[model samples]
Target: MKKIFCFLLILSLSAFGFYPSVSSASEKSQQEVKEAKQYVQKHVPILKNEFKKLSRSSSLEDIESLIEKHFKEYPAPQSLKSNKISVFDAFPEKQHKYEKFSGKSLNLNNLLNDIKTSSTGDVFTFESKDNTVKVLLGEFGDINILEQKSISNPSVSKAKTTKATGIQRQTGIGYGTYGTKLYTLWCEGNFSYNGKTVKVISKDGDYHKHPSGSILTLDPRGLGKERDASIGKYKYKEVFSRLRVEGVLGFKWGEWIYKARTVETYIGSTVDGNIYGGLKSYK
Candidate 1:
């Protein structure tokens, strides 16, 4: 009896066309994929050279000097230069305390080992004696240096606090085909913190005035939640202000294909002894 009921439910869903078939509708083509792979292969050698230099450094001053020289030769991104966001603070770390090598001499072997085992998009941090100096490394090979003075430590306030409020936006761009004719797809919208409140900003680039089948959707990350808290002596207000882009291609039979990517930028500040804003992963 249970099997019959389950079968009937699946049949009803199929009749309604709830599931669409997957196809070779990805935004990137085979050639583009090959080029991307080749780029990574060429970039690995440069990364290894830099890592060797960093690993051989005898002291924190040497590491700082090397980073400064490298930055002067190849400037950092505008966003990173202007914001000075510690890569360490921007993302969460697998380990909290640097207890393993707390008082010992600085060793990057553990960090290197962690990076070898970590997948892309993973973030890791290693600190020197007394947490005076920090090295933030992303699995994708981006690295940053942070000093103790740059880290924020806000004091707690006695007054009650209200939930954080902010706005978010998303933009998408990709291509699709309608029968034999090709079309470019694009969309953008502004939404409230929780993503429940939405306002379509634009939906241009579509050639068809009234296409046979079309669909656009938004998927919000780290938005609309009650994530306010207070520690022993510090009151922190966390906010996640970033942009996520998702592109879609539609077929004549009401089938759709999607490709999504996120561009995250976290800007934080402290004022009047209270932490007004902070990193997305900070608690």
Candidate 2:
């Protein structure tokens, strides 16, 4: 049953593709959605009653809550979201080999080979704001990320030729520790060194600051462990300037770790490809 659920989940997610223009197919669209719901109830009886119950209700809140319950109530025993990243916010000893680099978004096979770790059960953690989830080096896996290109934006990149000892920090009224401002760049723009672009983000490369040019000193090192403050002890959303994740994917909505064979990195061409900030990813 669990295997069937996973297969169905992947199928449904991958099936979310282009639809006909609504102007001429509004009724057909509505009918298809209804039929899709019926198909689920017909095959998955546990959802049968809930689907009927949801159909009679008109409140968005109720609909959302019901949808959540639909998955929660599934028979499979799954892990729920952690209250804290860890009880004391400490990370486990690193088990997988890690690497960090700035390069074009390539295929999963290429990325995996680039990592050069042949251990079974190995995973890749692209620290960019998006691609840090750990995925097993399975001969066969279910996550869609592995097949997708440019999923992570370089959330935090350092200077290439830094003469200083640490990243530049500023005290501003923003996120993380109250009144703790930092002069860090989010994963929104490109970073360059010398004449060639050195940094790349997964998306939003056109709307933010782009330096006419400057020299940078980019480093290639495996990320270190950073811990989250426990519970109320945390005043803001916890973040890691750098990290190497080692974890498993989950089936629930709250599970941030998704499984797929392909993932993406920022490409300089993608940044240059944007016309008036209308950048897009076709995968």
> Each candidate: what lDDT?
0.25, 0.21
Residue 50's lDDT within candidate 2 is: 47
Off by over 4 Å in 1: 1-39, 55-117, 121-236, 246-258, 261-283
Could you give candidate 1's per-residue lDDT for residues 175-211 as a string of tens digits?
Answer: 1110111111111111122112212221111112112
Clashing pairs in 1: 193-224, 194-224
Question: How big is the RMSD of model 2?
Answer: 21.9
Model 1 — TM-score against the truth?
A: 0.26
Output the worst ten-in-a-row residue range by lDDT, candidate 2: 1-10
Which candidate achieves the best lDDT against the true structure?
1
User: Worst lDDT window (10 residues) for model 1?
Assistant: 5-14
Compute each candidate's TM-score over C-alphas.
0.26, 0.20
Question: Cα deviation in Å at residue 213, candidate 2?
Answer: 39
- Candidate 2 lDDT over 6-41, as tens digits, reads 000110111111111123333233444343334333
Off by over 4 Å in 2: 1-70, 78-106, 109-186, 190-243, 248-267, 270-283
